[model samples]
Target: MSELMKIQENLRETARKLLANGEASLVIGYALGSEVSRVVPAFISREDEVDRLVWNPLCINNLAKYLLDYRHEPGKVAVVVKGCDSRAIIRLLQDNQITREKVIILGIPCPGLINPDLVAARLDPGAQITVAAVSKQDFSLQTGEGTFTFTRDEALLKKCRDCEQHTPVIADFMLGEEIPPNDPGDPFVAVKTLEELPVEERSAYWDKQFSRCLRCYACRNVCPACTCRECVFDQAEPCWVAKANNLPENTAFHLIRAFHVAGRCVDCGECERVCPVNIPLSLLNRKILKDMKDLFNVPTPGTSLEELPPLGAFTKSDPDEFM
Candidate 1:
């Protein structure tokens, strides 16, 4: 059996046992999407429904944020998490959005994931994938038509290319064998490139990117760090930012949000993934992350709960720029 199938089987059996024994009230996983190349979030509460659970390169979403939906529920909410998603789980725990006792984490060590759009383009959308396997080098899918193999360069998601963590940092149960971490060369390379540009060029570049904003707020909604009960952008009484979709308003929204999540952003790249206009939000957020590192020597946010966010903590050695 392929590694993907083994992991999928383990995930299904574990979820079944968790539900059948009343250990968990819910199991959040991935199910085959409408297209063979895509996967959607599956919330399974019954043992029989565990068969619907799947593990493949297409299971790309960070499922940790959904824990917020069940935080106040009766029993523990079990969730499947990859390395990146596990960071989100930690973020939620640190923020007190969900207590660790109320959550059951099932972790999967992922080498990488395929880009759905690229996979969809290679195969017929209606094709049913009978088998799939993911490796450090390539992704292979067995369909009714035939077997298709895509090199990592051809199919891997951009976010997964520089993945620093291959295994979840924390898990109640590990569903697969741990994969070694990849060397993420210069996580701040892009940020440094932008910094070297002239101030006028930098402003013009962002102005162009922000000008395409639809004000859909999809980035904010999908962000795990944005856990505020009522976001400032949505407040009409105070009207911090107008409802208009112009460049000024849009720039304000993005800039304000960047600052808000400055030290808290986990670098999950969901904002850039969900944006309709293809905004380089990861770049923007990483710029702040790079600054935080340079100024206070901090690692990526959500990587650990033991350390406090730079802005959330203070010390005698901290730089006081204003003074």
Candidate 2:
């Protein structure tokens, strides 16, 4: 069996024990979706349902957001998390969205995941994937029709290109062997490229990207940092943003959201992943993240629970730009 299969089996067994032994009342993982190229979040509450949990390259959804759904429930909830998703877990804990003791984290050292759109384009319609394997350099997929392979460079998700964290920083129970961290060489290459552009050119670039937005709010809804009880965009009385799907409204929404999550975004890349119009939401968030790191010398939020967010903390040494 490939290493992933072994991990999948271990995950199932762990979930089974958690539910059967009353350690957790719910287990959240991934299951086969209606389409072979898709994987949906699975919620297992019974020992018999643990078999529904599966792990594969296609399991890309950030499962941490679902913890908000169960925050008020009485029993502990178990969640499977990749390194990036684990950051979301920390985001919630830091924000007090969920208590740390209320959840069990099953961390998986991700090898990386394939971009679903790219994989879907290559797959035969309705093709069923039977096996998947990953190496340091490439991914191999065994489908019902035949086997296919792609170099990690060609098929890996953009977020994985400079992945600095392969092992979860925090986990109550780690499900797989520790994977070596990617070098993440010059992690800000894309951001730097944009930064080098002329002011007019950079403004034009974002204007074009934001113009294509449909105002669907999928980016906001999927974002783990967006936990406001009443989002500004959704307010009807003040109407912070008009509902019209025009460039001005769309740009306002995106800019506001990017600022709102600034210093708090874990850079999980889920907002970009779920966008139907394919907006590069990660770029916007990363731009702010880069600025934060450069200006405040603060480490990325969610990397550690003890590190306070720059916006959330006040220190005597904080830069005094006003003076």
Candidate 3:
């Protein structure tokens, strides 16, 4: 068995024990989606159903967001997380959205996820994946029709390119042997490249991206940092943001949402992935993240529970630039 298959089997067994022993009332993992190239979040409450659990390069959903759904429930919830998704777990814990005692984290040292769109373009329609293997430099997929391979650089998710956290920083249970960490390359390369553009050019670039937005709010909805019970966009009385899909309203939504999660956004890149129009929301979030790192010397939010957000905490030695 490949490492992924081994992990998948281990995950199922772990989840089964958790549910059977009453340790967890719910186990959230990924299962094969109806489509050939898709994997959907699976919610398993019964031990018998644990066989449905799966792990693959396509298990891309940030399962931590679903923990919010069960936060107030009576029993504990177990969740599977990759390095990026594990950050969301920390975000929830720090925000007090979910208590640590109430959730069990099953962390996986992710190799990386493939770009579904890129895979879809290469595969025949409805081609079923039989197996997948990951190596240091590429991933091979054995489909019903044939085996296809792509270099990590060619097929890995954009967020994975500069991934600093391949292994989860926190986990109640680790599902597999720890994978070696990748070199912490320039995490802000995209943001810095965009910053190099002229002021008007930058504005035009964002305007174009925002203009294509369908206002489906998939980005906001999928965002683990966006845990507001009543989001400002949903308000009707004062109407902080209009429901219209025009550029001004869209711009307002994006900017306000970004600032709201400025210190809290874990950079899971879910917002960018779920976006139908393919807005580079990660770039926007990372730009703010770079600023926070430069100004406050704060480590990334969600990396640790003890570290207070730069905006959430007051420090005596803080720079007095504004003062």
lDDT of all predictions, in order shown?
Answer: 0.90, 0.90, 0.89
Model 2 ranges off by over 4 Å: none
Ranking by TM-score: 1, 2, 3
Q: What is the per-residue lDDT of model 1 for residues 133-208, given as tens digits with 9 covering 90 to 100?
A: 9766789988999988999878888888668788997899999889988787888888889999999999999999
**What C-alpha lDDT, on a 0 to 100 scale, does residue 293 get in candidate 1?**
91
Q: Per-residue lDDT for 55-162 in model 2, tens only?
A: 889989999999999999999999999999998999999999999999999999999998777777788758877788889888888888888787888899887877
The sequence of per-residue lDDT tens digits that candidate 3 reaches over residues 198-252 is 9999999999999988889899999988999999999998999989899999999
Which candidate achieves the best TM-score against the true structure? Answer: 1
Please identify which of the two predictions, 1 or 2, would achieve the higher TM-score against the true structure: 1
Q: State candidate 3's TM-score.
A: 0.96
Q: By summed lDDT, which 10 consecutive residues of candidate 2 come out lowest? A: 116-125
- TM-scores, one per candidate: 0.97, 0.96, 0.96
Please identify model 1 stretches exceeding 4 Å from their true place: none
Quickly count the clashes in candidate 1: 0
Q: Which scores better on lDDT, 2 or 3?
A: 2
